[model samples]
Target: MPNLKHLLLLSCLGLSPACIDVPPLEDPPKEDPADPDADFTFTATPAQEQVLPGGTLDCDVRLAWADTTGGAVTWSLVSPPAGIELQPFTLPKGETRATLSIRLGAGTEPGAYTLTLQGKSGTVTKQATVSVTVGKAGDLVVNWVVPTPGKAYTRGPLLLQFTVEGGAAEQVEILKDTTVLVKPTGSPYSFTWDTTSEAEGTYQLSIRATRGGAVFTSAPRTVIVDRTAPTVASFLPAKDAVTVGVRDSIQVTFSEPMNPLSVTEAAVGLKTGAGDAIAKSVALSADGQTLTVTPLSDLTAPSTVQVDLTAAAGALTDLAGNGVASAPAWSFSVPTWLPMGGAVSAVGGATSTESVVLKLDHDDRPILAWAESDGSSKNIYVSRWNGESWFMLGAPLSGFSAIGTNAATPTLAIDTAGEPVVAWGETTGNGDERTVFVRRWTGTTWESLPSPTPPSSLDTLFNPSLTITSDNTINLFTSLYDTAGYSIICYQHSNQAASWQQPWELHDDPYLFNPGAPVSTTSGGNIFVAATVFDDHTSKRNIAVYKGKEPYLGGTTLGNSSTTPSIGADSNGRPWVAWSEFDSAPQSDGQIFWARWEGSSWTAPVAVNTRATGNSTPSLALAKGGPHVLTWSGIIDSERSILVSQWSANSWQTMNAPLNALSAAGTPATAPSVALNSTAQPFVAWTEADASAASIYVVRINR
Candidate 1:
């Protein structure tokens, strides 16, 4: 028997001694010493457990003997719950421990259950009980599928996946924030998220899993959906720029940030006019929006450069894995300007010359026409360059049978078959009556056009200007003096017509005199004539432009005190005029001025000559688009020299030096004529006079 203090200590130690019954202190039935009482106690550790419906609980059952000999113990479960399984095992001899395993089926119900365990050794038996509270399975778990976590998707199909654990799920849904994206079916719990229709932005993604009565949600994951294709916002040296610097770098700006790793040298290119690739290095800006291409060496002058950006699959890409929608391409030109070359004598002899006309053939060869004489009657001559020297085209054009007969004011044009056609004013008898005549070189001799009898209304005709249209129609413009007044007339001659068309009066104003009526044909076969007309109101000879025939569309007055106006038409049928005009006051000499017809009206006149004096006979020619090349005669350093200038980049740029010699001791160059070839290279011709003799000289650039 234990004292009250001992009982209290035993209870505090978790051992209750009150459960054990103590017999009175008396004599007991004695047994054989060899057959001592055999007894064992069955117990379980952790007698109470909390679990879910589809969970298992494991416990250990042990048997101990009071006698010295020990035997194996057989274990069994008593009154277990339905659908509950227990693993049965026998404890081996001399072993004091054994393991017990309990498993519940997935379809098991929730309830409070008591499981009994029994162990037997020979004829001795022991029993223990374990209390378990079975409830529903824990909440379902969801996880990411394809794009693990913290990943962005482009504007295309995106696959999402989630795995459910702990229990079978009846329904699963993928959500973006609070909005339901899709309700998926089938196994593996996956959905293909098509993000092509969504806008570019950031979104929170999560999964909702539901069973019979329980619902679970996964933590939100940040996802970025970007579907925008990069674009080229701007380019450095704008497209079709004609005056790009040789050392300029090509630059491109993007609409968004780009991937640095995707920008490589293979993604950009620079090429020459001849389609040859140039060496270049590519670099991306720090912000990844600007890309620059620097050529390893200086670019070629007077050449065109092409810039290209690659649109290949992996060539260029944005940070969100999007590529450029289309490749960007453009071309710019470096101006081709060279210093003037030395002047070369084209035709020189002991002969004096009058007016001269210069024109370039399709191959850039110079063709010249002039009226020359050897102290006698003047004769018309036509010559062309053979790349080395000049050669006469045919015999003398003026076949006069009487003395003192002369040919003057020669104008030249090239026909469709590249043959020289000349028109001149010829004195018919004893240099008294003058008439206009035309001749074409037929590779053998000069073939004269049918001469029409002069109408009785005109007295004399001079200043013949000629233009050949695309259809081989010969258009002639001449200044005439009649009994009424001095007038300008035009005549048309075609291969199909038996004779020249009747001359029509363009301007019949008596105040107009010395009308330098030059004719030019536009690409649309429309004729344009520029002349100097006297304005009675201002009492000045102002330059005027006339278009078409009879009821002329345009006869607008241009510069003041202007003369020797030359007209040319560009590809767009717009007219450009150049002439010589004297300064308003203080300055006494004439200067070269030019203007263009801008569809609605004429632009203000712009002076081209920078020299101080002697600017006359301005000739204008246009290139493919609208660039103007003007040449005129101006005196520099007290000597007459041929000056040249060009309209470029919205302003006129004069050449550094004169085209011919300006030495005071040398011949004076005058009456300059300028023409451009197919490539826009200029060729200039002028007559230099020395003593009583004059010679024709031509000059051009090396390129």
Candidate 2:
């Protein structure tokens, strides 16, 4: 440092003179080109361009400006034209670079436009030319494909598809011809057309595909909306009453064509004889007309069944809209009982010219008949009454081989159930013993009663009589003889419990003579057995009727003397007896006699018919609450014939006129058996020779 005073003066003089000479300190010496120290050179890339007419383009403007102060840069739009919008612009940090994007309005005119970009350093402008036109809407193309051509599908759902190309579709109309199926709004148009609602027919489908304010319809494609025709196949259980559960369906057969909806509206109904509709559930077949219904409950047999349909109801309708003219109702009957009818026969030959006689129950109709043939077994014959005519049951068991040799005449009686039963004897053994066989009819089945014993001794069971009581009990009576004599009367009883009582000897006598067939009748629980018993010499037969404890019931002989007394009892327990008496010797002709039993004894024999010839083999059948009909075979001239008479209005009416030829012929109709059915009409089973085969036959009396 210089000395304090003098050095200070020198330092001030130097500093002051220099400072004055600097000329106000001209800013640091300028470089060669005037202001070289200041920032100047910079450039922006791809800044200006022109766009084509109606064409779209994008422009990115980059900015570069030098800063004299050396700082960062940013850009912004300074001038924007009308209908123009500024896009995003960015700038770099600590540098002078910036970018901007500009868009022109759609309606801008074709002219030059300037883009002004302002940065931190300064603002710049870029010019562009644009040729503007107009915007265009998108186009649409539609197409369709038909899957099935002319084929008819079942009545149900159908599917279809549509295709659209070019621009995105806004709406799609799928039409079956002029009929619109689906009108939908969507992009990439496609649709399914359901033809379930359409009838069976060929159709054309057109798809109208629309897009972006433009619409186009595709060419119509031929499509068939076919449906199967309805049909009823067949009925069930076609023959008779069909038993089905409540849920079962009743099917009706249809030929063709049906509407399912219409069939649903029709009602299937069931009914009884009273015309009441049976409550049931009903349904229509898939194709319709065939209605299926179930009854609410089960039905009983022996009833009339009816299925009804109403005209107002749509039972079945075709595509033509033609319905059933009238609802058809079907009816059938349920069977109550099985059928039962067959032949009636006796198992023996007519050894004697005789009338076949049978008795019927109170509830049955009566049939009187007879049998006739030569004494030899071969010619045994039969004839009968047919409701409207006379016919035969069948040929008799006549020849020795047919009957196992030597068969006796037939005897008949009405069984417990009002059916006829027959019994007879067959001689097979060499010693003259006979087998007695029996059989009866019970409407549905034929029942055979077991013989009491096998044919045994020479003096065998003969002249067997059968009588069925009201309680379903059957009693049989026959003469039992030993080598000594024809003594005791043997009795057999059906106990009414499906079994028979043991045989017992009824009367004991050394010479009991011939005992006629027993006839029994009921008054409440009391049974009366009546018969004709011959005297010791077998000359005079006595009419006898018994009451109480039968077989052992105490009874007295009624009429003094009458041969072949045929006896019966009416519904009120009053007895009537008829017989024939020989006029002269034992070999002579006979006459008819009648008597009535009044509780204690018979009224006495009265002449019934008087003729020059013989009147014999008198048979009597008393109806429970009706008439007593009588039959007999008489000999007129040299001929043997048969006649019938009925007791009516306290007098006998001769039924012989219609049968006069037979009654007055050489060979009379004989072996007459009578039976009645529920209607109280007589049915006769007899043997006659006038017919072919000389067979056994049946005939129903007109009265």
Candidate 3:
């Protein structure tokens, strides 16, 4: 035998016997009484009849339960109506009372419902009935499309037709210009709007149908009438071409003398670039040469404007005896400009994280320069390498704060004389914000041109695009926003004065918004504008390419059904696009992709960087005589660095240069911007992490 402690420890370890024993307890059961009487009962209140397309019925039911035989009782629903749902019930425990609520869906048909209540001491039931009526009324269907968007009536005829089903109706009328044009057909049931002779805006057709001594009126449908010639009804005050903020009136003279009869409160109007109409207190000169349009509120200077003349609405006639057919749509803009630069020393700025620039001036100096900036700043500073020394032009512009921050996409083009014309977007006001501005190096000092120049209602006025035709006619394109659904691109031309030609709207679609800066080139007699369009429906970026001098081009999408990242063209007029490939998994890295337009169709996209990991935001550049270079900042070895690759011999070459060497954890090297200089050398600009702050950096690489 072991010691007591050791023996106890061994027992605890279950060596032989480690069990303990105790006694169990028992409880008593009570006797059962006579079967519990059926005491649970429920009843529903009658619901009022409801017509179709009316409010929901507020229905309720009373429920009660009792222990008639002193036995526990429960309540339950046994019957319910189709399409009806009952809400929670408040039932008591012993002498329980409860309320039940029900909701009927809209599609419920006319019918009676039987509701039942079940009591379970065992099984007993009680039931009641309720009735609801769902009646029917006919419907009117509407369908319409503008053959020509925004133009309203330009060619052919304006036709509108409506159909209604139910009982015979009367009094069908189609209204345009506030006067009824189309009346009910002989059937008195349908209507058609034919604008063979009327002018256009918005026309409404209203009808009333009657059946069984009751009348139902169909909702009004709108038809646009276009019969008038487009006119320049008004020019904004600064059309005096004066600096903004000068107290001035809008100058609006008609294309022809107005009908003193048609220029009423409804016919003549003034509106902002934003589409908000000037208030009713508009003051007009009796001679009608100028109209002083004051806003209902204090106005902001440098705003775009449109002056409309009701004279086109069958009220005025042109000098040629033609009735003014279409309401004139004239657009005017506030001039804004960037005011710095000198003697074309250097040019280029990173347009964004995905763009780069290398600008070479026409000046004889052997200076190599580049420009690039991140979002939120307006300065396009230039750096020059004159073989032995490097010189920087102006300091980067802050957007326009007392410290100016946001910089526009600055594009540089040198006139034949080596004078540099800088086109870009800049902050015009602290609150209203952003304008497309231009500046020229006028032999002595950099001068600002008239600004707030809007290309289209849909344009953002940044990311300017410029193309100098063989004739030196500079064609510029930018993006604008409209109150209506789509964004637009505006076009302007200039050859002599720094002033741009009257701007024209190019692309305006309810489906396209924030189109990328335009890229253009003239081939033969056709002008081509290729831009990135953010499709509202697909929520993806599409490349919309249009041809001709028309403001907008018919757009075509390119690549593997993915949004594009950047686009460019070479001297041969071949357009190039770079974008990210579609990734099957979210959060997966996107691969760099490229596509080319071969004069007929867009080539299928080829993977430029085939990393399962990821690379993105690619920018492309091409020198007339060599391979195309595509550069971007991407992640490698879990680090973010600037990468460049070239397309040569029908294939992509591996990228080797790394612009940033900092730890990749918190630092971001993004928005790779690129440009090509006079010698065909490519210069790239970008914003990089500088230990504690952010700074703009550049690198030049030969192709």
Candidate 4:
């Protein structure tokens, strides 16, 4: 085209066409892009938040900067609800995150709200939007931690626990009905409600939680406060019952329901009269109101058993958590009577006559006194069983030898020192005069007591009965007969007195014969006498009982056509009498009847012998804390046999076999006497007469 310069100029001048054909000088090499501004981005971890009135919510705000360095960022909330506040805070320079706390104040309305969070640094600003919800009363809930609803509480401490959800509790209170009972402050809210001072009734319980100035209450829970203690409603084997079975179980009923778990073997127990513990098992009824105690083994016969309920802490508790304040106890007894060893003959001879008197010493040894003739004369003799054989106590008490002058009607008793005391009637040579003699054994010899005054010459003393009192006094009762009539006399001799006391006529009715051998006993410092008197007007003999002295307490008639009256006393100082009564027409034999004097009157007479045979000469004795024992002679299968029976369990229980005359079927056994030992055993003494002579025999019954 043209010269270089010219061509260049022309090409340059021709720019329109040349510039289009030539590259546009490569657009002057474009420069690299520059970095962004040094600012941060504001964002929230969660886009939603929930908070209850008087509660707080926390949100995490993060800053993402484009550069390694940044200034402090101020935090703020936009368009927040009334009473809502954002905790003033700022993210320091070089920090990447900050916490935003949103708090709702008291009395704040509940609703859904949107909160805009703003963060600004120098001339830069960033914003984040978050959804917020203010919780209402329905959002706050209270749950019971223990003592579930509808449970009853007794007079004790009760635990109350509760938890608050959807809110923070600053203070918690327990409300009983509309009243505030207590204010508890702690985590896992709980309190001990002492109900010991509360009245018994139904009440409503609730939990009240307070945060800031707002309060929330839970629904009412129904509960019962029963502060009444349980009582013993009834028990088995009624107190002091004497007829309880050996295998009977004890039952105790409560006035209200009891806690089943509290009824254990350690809480109830049984014991023997000896204070020995008895093994037993305890059980509770289905309704949780009764408790039963069963012995592991059968109780011993003739033993007293006691039942005990413990009153110790944690021993027994009712459903309301009340404990027994007092221990309950009771006692009962079992009865048994069985014969011991075979009967032994005390004395046998060709001339042993009259009734034999028997007594037991402190050692339970048998002592005897009777009248026997040696063909030349009759005298009163004393003997005792050494647990082996009979040994004479001393020489015959009387020295009479004339044919008509003889010893008879010997009555025997034992003193407090376990010494023998004897009383008898001795007739003079002419038989029209008789004297009453009493003597006591002083270790080795018989010491004669003062002799009672003699009646008129024609009057004769026949039968004599004697007893020794607890105070060492001698009491003697006798029968006197004269031309005018017969009368019974009572005489007493005290160890301190100079001589026998003035005799008192017990009964003096002309139509009444001398009461035969008026039996006497001492109880509660008073003397009681019983006898058989012949009533000429009724043409029948009747039994009479008298108590005390001079101004007698009783002259009560017991039975008609009755004989052989025996008297005794009980632990309560009450008098008990037994006798033989003749049956009605067609029955020639007699029956034994017994009666006890109550505080005011006498109980109805009860028959002792079950059979209709001739039962006569009955003797009665009462054992301490035991039953009454009786012995008599009866005709069985045309043979005379001695019978023994005991009044127990409201009935008479007769021994299985006859006591005497078992080997000699035709021998006649008569005039029986009974006594009880210290161990409550019964001993019987009787007379057996064969074709040759009469003899005395003794037997015992074990418990």
The whole-model lDDT of each prediction reads 0.71, 0.50, 0.50, 0.72
Model 4 ranges off by over 4 Å: 1-349, 399-405, 455-457, 507-514, 535-539, 550-555, 583-587
Candidate 2 lDDT by residue in tens digits, 591-689: 777877666555656776545366776767777556667766665556555566767878777753423222223434544445445554445444445
Instruction: Name the TM-score of candidate 2.
Output: 0.42
Candidate 3 lDDT, 349-393, residue by residue in tens: 423332334445565332222233444443565445455355654
Clash totals, every prediction = 0, 59, 62, 0
Residue pairs that clash (backbone atoms under 3 angstroms), model 1 = none
Candidate with the larger TM-score of 2 and 4: 4
* Lowest lDDT 10-residue stretch of candidate 4: 17-26
Candidate 1 CA-lDDT value: 0.71
Winner on lDDT (1 vs 3): 1
Clashes of 2: 59
Query: What RMSD, rounded to one decimal, does every model reach?
Result: 33.3, 40.7, 35.5, 35.2
What is the model-wide C-alpha lDDT for candidate 4?
0.72
Off by over 4 Å in 3: 1-356, 363-380, 394-405, 430-432, 455-460, 507-514, 517-528, 535-539, 548-555, 560-565, 581-588, 661-667, 677-680
